[model samples]
Target: MNSEIFSREIIVPQSAIDARGHVNNLVYLEWCLEVAEAHWETKANTDLKKKFAWYVLHHSIDYKASVFEGEQLKVETWIANYKGAKCERLYKIIRLTDQKIIIEAKTDWCLVNANTLRPSKITEEISTLFV
Candidate 1:
């Protein structure tokens, strides 16, 4: 596992399927957040978590292909870049069975003071953890 890139595998769930028999678009967004949160929580120390939090500023996703229930997927994420209080994280959801990228996305996030809930500059300490 590359320290900079976080990945996890999951089977498409029935609840994520829509009437079209494919995973709903919104579910992709959910997966993005889930993976990002897991990466942060796993890497950050207790004091880091208590001092800082992240909030999504924007999400941009591309649906490359549809996936059905029970299809296995490999979700991967990495920080692309950071500036001031914000950073962009990139995602790729791949169909593991076929090795095809089903979804591609990027999310802009803002770092905030956990107590004040106001934007805070992303220091080298915080940015280096993900990059």
Candidate 2:
């Protein structure tokens, strides 16, 4: 386990399952956003969050295995890199029962001014949290 990673636990809900009887593709992305939001809220200060906000620029997910309803999952995420106003966040969704990786994903996020919604630099205060 990486010391820099932030982790969260989730349960597969029946509503998240598709007609194919497995978690839907979109649901995986939702989980990624959920965990990321949780991480930010927990780690970032109110003043920083009030000054800047993040917007997703891109998301890439590789489905390695299927997850079903009632299954427990561990979502581990960390900042892979940051440049200018953008950062790449990495994620791994593991099925706790067998300890298998169900999904591997990365999302590109850009920092933006909370009020103006324009691209903003990654400030030291924000960067230190991920580091």
Candidate 3:
């Protein structure tokens, strides 16, 4: 398995909160996606996949603590592993104050030929970059 850690700051907006008044558990996944997208754009230097062109095959997450509205959070993600068409990424949300872990997440994605809409072998550039 290979991994890359990425860091970015995010604000927990009011709309991101649940009825319980903290961040909606599901919103954490959005955080991971944002971080991963930036990492990919930086490494791949492209966003042709940005629209609806590229998609995630799977997403997994674990919320460790409540992330409240107005809090500044750190989103950290890694390209954890890949095999054939599948690539797995992991994420963690940290509170800046005490460095507390707010969440853990993982996502699996596939690189596809935009025109064909079928899974394509990860490009050698990506494989080498991830390595």
lDDT per model vs. reference = 0.93, 0.92, 0.79
The ten-residue window of minimal lDDT in model 3 covers 45-54
**Model 3, span 14-43: residue lDDT tens:** 999999999987788877888888887766
Candidate 2 residues lying further than 4 Å off, grouped into runs, are 1-3
Q: Predicted candidate 2: what Cα RMSD to the true structure?
A: 1.7
| Candidate 1 lDDT over residue span 14-121, tens digit each | 999999999999999999999999999988999999999999999999999999999999999999888899988999999998899999999999999999999999
Pick by lDDT: which candidate is best? Answer: 1
* TM-score on alpha carbons, each prediction: 0.96, 0.96, 0.87
lDDT of 2: 0.92
Error of 3 at 6 (Å): 1.4
Model 2 compared with the native: what TM-score? 0.96
lDDT of 2 at 70: 100
Candidate 1 matches the true fold with a TM-score of 0.96
Per-residue C-alpha lDDT of model 2 across residues 1-131, encoded as one tens digit per residue: 12289999988989999999999999999999999988999998889889989999999999999999999999989998888899899999999999999999999999999999999998777888976
Instruction: Tell me how far the alpha carbon of residue 88 in candidate 2 is from the true structure, in angstroms, after superposition.
Output: 0.3
